[model samples]
Target: MRCPFCGNLETQVKDSRPSEDGAAIRRRRSCQECNGRFTTFERVQLRELMIVKRSGRRTPFDRTKLERSIAIATRKRPVDQEQVDRMVSGIVRELESMGETDIQSEVVGELVMKALRSLDVVAYVRYASVYRDFRETSDFAKFLGDEGLSDNEDT
Candidate 1:
């Protein structure tokens, strides 16, 4: 592996282990040139997945983009990084298991909303407002009501 710190071409793996979830392999490595240490993770790619946008445009699925969106929703909430990661992983696994090369953007959004609903209510609302395109208070009210969430639950 190439060393990220010094751009060295040579690196030695000092340790290797499966990640906590066993979905990936974590490797600790040191650059042979600078002796700098770094960690790397390897995940299996079941297949190339594409996202079908609302505009009917198809694009390759991006994991980082999904993570960023979820992170924004969970920001400043009690949700920890590990939980966010697990949610992302779960979504990805579900998508992969679907065995479809192309998936609707709405499907992905709904999956995120569902995951956030269970993780944190505030985060769910935050994500819902943007995903559902809430323009008025009534939109939020209707969404809460449809989801069977009472005002008391938000507190």
Candidate 2:
């Protein structure tokens, strides 16, 4: 692979290991020209999946969107970036395994919420607030009081 920093085509792999989740392999490389080091991920690319939005519009699945949402929800939490990455990968794998080209947006949202809920309640609530569009205090309260919600006061 070309070096990202120096645009050098020649690079040496310093290390290679499977990612924690085993979905991809992470390679540490050093540019022969500039000695710059960087990491790259090699993963299996699955078939494209389309998301059916609430407005009845279909769009290609966007991984960045899922990552961004998870990042926002996990902000300031004990969760680490690797955990977030694994969660996103798991969700994508689950969706693809269903063999559905078009998945409802609600399904995607629920997947995120479910993953976040297990990671951290505060994160779960933060994600749910935006995904579910909680406008009123009651809406927030109901979510907090939901049966599946953690009863921890800190959340």
Candidate topping lDDT:
1
Model 2, 40-151: lDDT tens digits are 9988867889999999999999988899989988999999999999999999999999888999999999999888888888898889899889999899888878734545
The lDDT, on a scale of 0 to 1, for candidate 2 is 0.90
Off by more than 4 A, model 2: 147-155
- In candidate 1, how many Å is residue 131 off? 1.0
Clashes of 2: 0
Top candidate, metric TM-score:
1
For every candidate, C-alpha RMSD to the true structure in Å? 1.5, 2.3
